[model samples]
Target: MTRSLGFGVLLALQFLTRLPVPVQCPWNADTSRWAVRCYPLVGLLLGGILALTGRLLEGWLPTPMLALLLLSLWVALTGGLHLDGLMDVADALGSNASLERRWAIMKDPHVGSFGIIALVFLLVWKGTLLLALLESGVSLAVLVAVLALGRFGAVALLVLSPAARPEGMAWAWKQHLGHRDLLLALWPLPLCFWLLPGGMVLFAALVPFLLLYGLAMIRAFKGINGDIVGAAIEGGELWLLLVAWIWWSSAMG
Candidate 1:
């Protein structure tokens, strides 16, 4: 019980989506481990912020500009945190060599041609979806719902995956991913139904997207180590971004 609350607070503080209450844990024990566990919850909280931001700015700017700004907001709020991982992951997968070579590329911390292309396409994909969602008159629900689920998606990975590393934060989380892990992970799923009136239709649609996403990341994980957690988060976000964009984009035009 204490661990869960502590995990939740660490997430709120780090993600800084401006939640109402303080995101403080019970004394910051094992901060790094907690950070990994709470990482996905950040996306869920951002869902509310995303909706509020959208509502506040609706009709105040053009859809494209608003979309761009919305994404910019996330970049600033998270301190360009996951986007960097997205780039690294892209660079890793961007390689056509063996798994060992891809892992080497991911750790370089240098951007390559493939990294640049993937990052741009993902940002555009996310921004375009936001614009389309706002334009489609479903901005509030879709933004909030998708953001929430995307985060949940990350947590799901935590519950399902074993730490690829032996002594790092990911390893620590592996120790904690016992029965209680399911409690934190499953609680967020139902929230989607409330946020999106489309209900299970939206949920059903996300499954295949997630499946393909998981498969793609498996190849990357096989190459790199557990550092791919960061990459997985960004991948989940991008997947949702594309899903939302395609749905609302089709509706708008």
Candidate 2:
């Protein structure tokens, strides 16, 4: 069981980030199930790296520059995989076309004008939030908490929601996942609460956000897909940061 779980973590690291795992985990139902369960753990590892980077750079750089660097590192870590999904969803939604047409738009390799605009807006807003958090002397644990929660929400959405299509990676992944897997992923929830100040309140707020966001995506896309899941991770992380920043600012003031 331990070995299987380790392989699962490796599978998740390989899929979710650009990190080199250096070993091939045989892909099958058990490993895939473990992979889904390990999503939040992978996110926690990412958060740890980002938190360490922020701590090391806190003294040397200006807030704005530090925020930019952190944001760049965030993208570099994920290879902008979620960002691409965010852009694709933006283009599809902006087209305001039929459902089928929107799906087709998302499948297109070329990004549209809407995608570019959304990307700019997302990055700018994220940078601004990061700057605010840094300026206010926010705890590094908040960053770790937010990232873990964001990925946990993504995992929840994947298992709970219906797929937008009957095929593709999302659908195939879902085949190996169930409510039990979601329960296993719940390990991160308590850790997130322990990691943040007033964590209970923050987590309470996050539950509704995830629910509403998941519902909105389901409505907009007709169901969940890889792109939808990607958008959720990006959107959830940003929202978590925004909430944490606001809470920190209010508490400090």
Candidate 3:
């Protein structure tokens, strides 16, 4: 049982981040499905890395530079997988084209003008938000909560939404996701409450926005896909960061 859990963790890490986790287990739908349950664990791992990076470099560099560095580290760690999805979605939406055209555009390797603009705005927003949180004396724990919460949002979408594509990573991940998987994905919730000052309040604020975003994706794309899931992770992070920033500002002031 422990060995299986380890394999699931390895699979989750490999899929979610650019982390090295060697695994020789046979690849099958069963194993692929179980990886979804371990999504929050991957988020916890990322949150830990982000928190450590921020803490270790707190006073070593200027806050703005430090924020940029941390943002770069975050992108590097994930290999910009989610960012790519976000850009693709942006490009698809920006194009005044048919649904099929939009889908085709999303699958295209080359990025469009909208994608570039979206990526720029996302990076700027993230860097500025991180700077604000740091200057406001927000604890590293809040960063950890924000990261975990974002991944949980992804898990929620997987469990709740049907896939747009008949084939692809999202369909495979959705196949094994059930109520049981959803319960497992909530493992990080308690830790979040312990980590953040007003965790419950922030969590309440996050759910509605995430649900609305998920619904919008369904309407826009007809259903969810891997790109949509990736977009959720990126979007959820921004939403949670906004809530945390507001909470921190109000609490500190």
Candidate 4:
């Protein structure tokens, strides 16, 4: 069970950050689905790593360039996992065909108009939020907490989501996650949330934020499948970015 929990934690970490964690076997069928489902946590880790790294580099370089360098590293580290999802989902969502057509398009390795546009927007938004957080002089702990909680919000989608495809890892792990897993999975969130002194209000807001995103994603998945699930990770990241920005704005006001 140590291996399974470790894998799960890594999966969470993978979804939460951009840092590379060792993979025993990557791209194999046995571990592939676990890897994919756990990807959002990779973004969370990216945020935290960037948060720490950004602080270290503060006053050492141009803030935007510093943020960009760290941000680029994150994209490279996770192999742009969620960005691909965002692209695929954008392509599928913009199409007018039936569910099967959407799924077929998502599987193609080609990029499309919608996907390109989506990537541009999401990256811009994420970068903007990071720069703002830094400019606001937000504590590094708050930055890390935002990163972690954003991911916890993303995974909450899996808890509430239904699998969109029968052949993929998402489907394989659909029933694998349950309330028991949720209780265990969610354990780290509170401490992360508590990292900000009065951050509880913002933390509570993630519940509805998660619910809206999760349920809307389920509807999309029922039509779109795994590509959209990947898309949901980016969507979750975007949501977190927005929330952090709003909170920072309010805090500054």
Provide the clashing-pair count of each candidate structure: 0, 0, 0, 17
Which candidate number maximizes lDDT? 2
Ranking by lDDT: 2, 3, 4, 1
What digit string (tens of lDDT, one per residue) describes model 1 on residues 1-253? 5675666556545543434445455434344445544544555567667678878988898888887888888776666666777787778777877877876787797899888997798777777766766766765766566655665555556566555446544455566555465455545556766766663555566567656666666655642234465556566666666666676666667
Which residue runs does candidate 2 get wrong by more than 4 Å?
none
Worst 10 residues of 3 by lDDT: 25-34
How far out, in Å, is residue 58 in model 3? 1.1
What is the TM-score (0 to 1) of candidate 2? 0.96
Give each model's whole-structure lDDT.
0.63, 0.87, 0.84, 0.63
lDDT per residue as tens, model 4, 1-253: 4455457556555544455767753333334334434443443455567667877888998878876776686577557876897898788768867877977788879999998999998888877877777777766666556555655554555556666656765555555656554455455555656666755655676677667756665565573244555666566556756776677778778
**Candidates 1 and 4 compared by lDDT, better number:** 4
TM-score per candidate, in order? Answer: 0.80, 0.96, 0.96, 0.82
Rank candidates by TM-score, best first: 2, 3, 4, 1
User: What is the Cα-based lDDT of residue 103 in candidate 1?
Assistant: 67
Which 10 successive residues of model 2 have the least lDDT summed?
196-205
Q: Which runs in model 1 stand beyond 4 Å of their true positions? A: 2-4, 15-41, 223-227, 245-253
